[model samples]
Target: MESLSTKSQLDMARNVHDMGSINKMREAIASGDETVLQEAAQQFEAIFVQMMLKSMRKAQDALADENSPFNSQQVKFYRDMHDQQLATDLTSGGGLGLADVIVKQLGQTEDSYTPASVIRSDGDLSSLNRNRVYNVAEAQDIALSSQSIRSPSAQKD
Candidate 1:
């Protein structure tokens, strides 16, 4: 494997989204190519970490200043680049251990393994907890009830 620059590595990581690139990664793992397997696993892990970071950022949108000059497209681009680099660095530093798990599982099998059955659960909300499924009214009621339960002395402060 030739040494690739950060940009090249990022490009390769982006290519992992393509079916052909995924198939090639599977083939490399099946062949027990340690270098390729490690690279692919790390890239996959970085993607996962990046997704997590994106989700966290999205969740923080409510707290963001809407009128800030730093909220422009250029800032967003830089933030995304920062996130990508952070994901890569985290994965290289033994991240959430996803890469290790992926490498271990792939290394254990001589051939690529496929599930015998596929179960689809699209649009299913039955698994959600009551709190997660609560309507706005119900949530407000809960908040009010909780506030009512607070001690008068504590509330005064």
Candidate 2:
């Protein structure tokens, strides 16, 4: 289990928000009038595809952020694993397949989420709940601990 750093947690927060929005957009298309649905279907798929691509970029951003302790090599490894999983899923006719890949890699699926980022009744991005994502005692507390082990000067100020 890999503990999420602040940045990684934030990324998860954003990912959840984005995914919720995407799903809502999808649902709206489904519930809308026939002409609206038809028009939205094409635009929605394009936007969803872009959302998937953006998520990949955001994942890398989280791993590379200054607050993260993970090096490029480590991030690359995780990213590659996710990419491969996504590719396999896509090849199997799965759409986007990001949520599954994230779930498989992180063991935290987006749907029915309680911990991490919060969402609205319609599943839109709501205020983030801090307690849900990171805690010192969690098995996956990869984030650098608040307790310092090195000299004060040696740590980042």
Candidate 3:
């Protein structure tokens, strides 16, 4: 029953003019289901993709020949419909990875976020050298030397 609502919401989500999707989004939030939250993120990403397509179309139209039949308003309407469907299809197929990022960010509790720059993609942690032991004596000698340098009275000629 909830899955049907999610599927319908995903469908309606493709059309920006559909107000029911907003209510559906509220329901998803109220339900607090992980699956519904994921769907909501995808739905949002699909809408974002549709808007990007619309912006690209607008940019293309700026250089278009107004006198040509191809640039007609009717053509634009159908093109927008096509773009909406395309956005939906693209989102269903893992999207631009924006939906995944969205879910990952929102799913984290508070202390679990590893900053983007700190996340290594190479699958190598050798650079961190977590197993290396510190030489406490060497560290103490260095710290004392620095302290003596700062307080010249402690430095012997």
Q: For each candidate, give its TM-score against the true structure.
A: 0.51, 0.21, 0.57
Query: Would you list the C-alpha lDDT of every candidate in the order shown?
Result: 0.71, 0.46, 0.78
Q: Which numbered prediction scores highest in TM-score against the true structure?
A: 3
What does each candidate score in C-alpha RMSD?
A: 12.0, 20.1, 11.8
Clashes of each: 0, 2, 0
lDDT of 3 by residue, 1-157 (tens): 8767776765656555677767777776677645666777887898899999999999999999999999998999999989987897889879899999998878897689787777765665474453343455667779877754566554553
The residue-by-residue lDDT of candidate 2 on 1-157, one tens digit each, is 1222422332332332244544544544455422223223333343466557557767767767676666566875676556544443343333555444543444434674575343335554345543554343463554354454556787766
After superposition, the stretches of candidate 1 with alpha carbons farther than 4 Å from their true spots are 1-32, 110-157
Report lDDT (Cα) of residue 81, candidate 2.
56
* lDDT value for model 1: 0.71
Clash pairs (backbone) in predicted model 3: none
Instruction: List where candidate 3 sits over 4 angstroms from the true fold.
Output: 1-18, 111-157
| Candidate 1 global TM-score | 0.51
